[model samples]
Target: MNTQDPLSIGIVGLGNIGRYHAEQLTSLMGSFDIELSGGMDIAPTARDRFESSFGVPTYEDHEKLYETVDSVIITTPNRYHEEYAVSALESDINVLIEKPIAHTIESADRVATAAAASDGVCMIGFHNRFASPVQVLKQYQQQARFGDVHHIEAKYIRRRGVPGRGTWFTEEAASGGGALIDIGAHAIDLALYILDFPQVTEVSGVTRSIFGGRPDYTHLEMWGRSGEGPFNVDDSASAFIRCADGSTISLDVAWAANRPPNNEFVVQGNDAGARLDLSDGDLTIFESSSAGAPHFSDSEVRTRDDDPHRIEQQRFIQASRASEAPTVNTVEQALTVQRVMDATYRSNERGRAVKIDSEPLPTVD
Candidate 1:
């Protein structure tokens, strides 16, 4: 890794995640072997803040920022991800678009198309795929420790937590669905990836905005906004998913709920079961058998909280230099997650099991 090779990095969108990446770039200046060429944000105040904090060049125009950098990270809102990603890729700059590539499948397709048309690199930020616990689970599952996974149950419930009250997050069009699209998307991606991305057969679910207009719902404020703003999105969602191999996944997500637990998931198979609790930082496995007394067991390895985002960024850099495909590259792979999301929304609308397009979209070169 040569520091003088001008591996210039540009950051689009100066939100929390964007700022985190910017700080990472600043911290990795010595060892990571890269340059923070510049950064862009639509808000001038944000740009000013970024420049003041990091002493990096700031551009109000993203295009100008793109012209000066070799690679760009799109951390904008969901609606604008495709716009900035496509723009950067068209400029022959490698790009790493944040999760939920776009609000719509069509936009995700366009971003992939632009990347394929050019020789530039493009990858979606599915960071959890890089976490150590997740990687370990994947390895064990690959070794068939669970003896053929038959079912998975996941719950990402929070005790009264909802993001920026009146901001773009609560808006349906800008951020897509509320709870399901936000936290549920991560859970969905994790489960699907672990399941070897089983072919989704059918999806049925319901979504509700239990306290969208309730002023009393003030105990948990995710975005740190006041209650006067409209919260016209689903606060909770539940879905029943059927895989092509006859396996099932019971998924539930709630940004705000009066539950005793925070966030947890259980992956079960004939031979064993494992519990993953993000808040507690634990991934415990339970070995069992139908012939003996039901029991629990734990692997002797310690779980280290690996910084998934940093690992994801490093992988992008490696892939860019090596001209290799990332673990989760292709728009079609992303669409697999999107299909479940779309079906969930449709099922909520129709109150019935909706069929999914099992056939993946054409792969991009």
Candidate 2:
């Protein structure tokens, strides 16, 4: 096979995000060389509509689709990511899983093990890492713009926003948890990526179902409309983490909070600080001063320029070709995030600090 030739890709789970990937691939037509091998989805309605609209063969079973494509993209719910990804990788097919990897740390471990055992590449979808502004921040870190990183604060706050609430999202068995596991996963991943993934030594957290636990809370809407159904999961969560390097990360996430000003990720260091606001694709940098003049100074600014999805796709394909390890959120990183989530919930339930299970995460490399 020619190294320059495009690879065949089979996408599993043709949901809304999956459709976006398909459209993006088609939009790149001539410039972006690739073949859409087709897809598989358990949903009959989704499969029929996707095949009819895209003119791509649809497989009801993923095993049949895996036999046809060189690589598979898993975009199913968080709970199913590990099962699907492991199945694909075990069959010697590369896999690109959507965010969060899996609902549990143990499942994440299985996915990583399968990837390591097979002769295929595996990568997790952390699209924010591909943004231009984020890339600049990474470059700044490489250049030591932020000397001796120490603290991070991330917020994924939304104003009355919970997707498919009372549906799969609110169900702990299906879409994982509520807003924290869904959106907060991205924020946590981004913060860890920026900080070079410091080893978390301890985590203390709390979860709240302030809005969805009451009878009157039934009026709250989910996904898009009002009163979709009953929501039982936490609408918000907050945590504090101490890293092995003595650095710290403060995280807060919400599906529907009465707070003003949407979402942001602020990374502070001894020498400088970089803040990325989710509402807009902007990153503001501030320089720290040892000598007193209000304690901080301003520095160079960077902004996102390209579509994060496109860059992420290109990177995954390239990594697949090389059979190289994932530099970003591999299974190990994902499991770490899951550990934090699990501990947070446990702490919330027990009304105290939950001890983390100290175990080394498996590596894709």
Candidate 3:
């Protein structure tokens, strides 16, 4: 990228997510030297809306958009990720793909393989890691403030927030899994990230399709599927993950559950603990202080409220300009998250814990 010229950026899958990134990237044009080259989607209606809304040209195929942009954000459905991402990488175009890397382990493996062989960079969209609180907590962990961090209880629950019954989100073939892949993927990735992306040994999980199949399912809000569609996937999932460093993670994720939603993560360590509200950036640390006799202490960490999506977008463009594969959110790290998701589904089927082999992971050194 020339300093005199802006870094050309593009977006794929002009659905809700695609428009979201376009809006963010557009808002950032004045701050950073970047352009929203164009948008691409298979749907004509979506393309029309994107062009009118953003005033950028739209495409029905990724090939044309790929010819124009240096880097692209693939925010399409999980199944279509591999198609656009691999094509872009082969052309040496950087990609920032959305979470759950691909629809299945095999597809994710192919994407990762392409990233490895290509001269382009690919970063997974686990955008939650860019949140202010998460960054602060990670810094504390690096400082050894949370000594011997052992376990993380990650929860991303919704009392009744299903995307309705007949959408790509509820379709297993398109989405991989329901709540596990949709929201639980974030919980799993964030927990693994906080623990410095530990090596996993085993995973035991149970997936349930409680409310999604019900004809009279009650929900306060639905994100997609206006009327009714095919709902053949799990709506909730629970998993217990075992790590090689004697650390464990208890995961609870649901799109629709009977209990009230609790979107908080509890990080337990030998010396201290923390409770973070996933909705907001409120974080409180729990520790026992030795001053003035042993006693418990609580410290609230207040951080700036910046949009994680915008932050991630800026980082991707900057990193892509620096190296073919910038190490912020590596494809390997996302693959590990995919392995856990894959293992969770397997465990659900076999009714037993599944074992995973540890592998060396790439980092942002």
Candidate 4:
């Protein structure tokens, strides 16, 4: 496909995130020479809603949707990621799959293998990496500003933020694990990206289902339908990860907890340290003076107002048009993060640290 031609993009799964992507793509059409080739959702109501809101065609079948567009954005539930992504890749259609790649390492590997064999571009949606502050940190890391990194600490906690308490999110079979696979995936990806995705040597972790199935659990807001259903997933998880380079990472994620909400990523290096507040996208750098005098410097790096989701989509479009892979949000990177997450769950189950033997996958470029 010529880069100059208007790229046609379709969305599969017209759920919350899918709708958001559709809106963003629509907004982007004003600037980019592209076409919103409608969307697909299994639910009839969702399809009707999407078609009514966007005045674009909506299909009940993914194959039909795939036949209409050059690229596909998969916003389906975790369980369906592999199926949709593999199908799209097999059809020579570019794909941008929402994060975690798939619910399990096996499924993620299938998607990765498909991407490796396909000529079309494939990217995982780790939109947090597109944040201005994260971009700056990436720049700093590239320049070796944080020489000899020692460790990274990432937290994506919530006082009460469980989604669909009785829905697919609370079901292990549908959403994989709980907090670790959901928001925790973002934290892990961000930390790994900052650390240049060092191979994880070992992982020790624990998960809890404290709040799920609790009738008294309270939150500022609730997502999806709330009712009596199986809530078998973890509500909180913590993990200690050791990398091949001797650097360590401490990760904590929770959908509901008793503590105050905190969302941040801190990278600690021998020479300098940096912190990114995931809540506001603000980055703070800490450094000591090289002079004899004992002095410290703390600087806050302001972030851009750019919507990360939009930035992510724009890049996906650009890469797809060029038939090139994304440098940051590649399938390999997602696979690495997935491996760490899988290791975390395994460690929790084994009640000890689990050894990670999977080597990093090569990048498409």
| lDDT (Cα, 0-100) at 230 in candidate 4 | 84
- The C-alpha stretches of model 4 lying farther than 4 A from their native spots are 1-4, 290-292, 359-365
lDDT of 3: 0.89
Q: Write the per-residue lDDT of candidate 1 for residues 1-365, one digit (tens) a residue.
A: 23357578889988777889888777766766677877899899889888888788988889889768888888887889888988887877788888787877677778777877766778888777787877778888899998888888878887777787667677877787688888888888788877888889899999999865476766633654554446778888899999999888899998887777557768898877787776666788888554577555666445777787877888877766655556564455677777788889899999899998755565556
With a 3 Å backbone cut-off (N, CA, C), the pairs that clash in candidate 2 are: none
lDDT tens string, model 3, 179-269?
Answer: 9999998999999999998889999999999888888988767786554568899999999999999999999999988997888999999
TM-score, cand. 4 vs. native: 0.97
Off by over 4 Å in 1: 1-4, 224-229, 289-296
At residue 350, give the lDDT of candidate 2.
Answer: 84
Return the TM-score for each candidate structure.
0.92, 0.91, 0.97, 0.97
- lDDT of model number 1: 0.79
- Candidate 2 lDDT over 47-126, as tens digits, reads 99889878989998899998888888888878899888988888878888888788776787788789878888888887
Across 256-286, the per-residue lDDT of candidate 4 in tens digits comes to: 8889999998889988999989797788999
Which candidate model has the greater lDDT, 1 or 3?
3
Q: What number of backbone clashes does candidate 1 have, counting pairs of residues 3 or more apart or in separate chains?
A: 1
Candidate 3 residue pairs in backbone clash: 166-229, 166-230
Ten contiguous residues with the weakest lDDT in model 1: 220-229
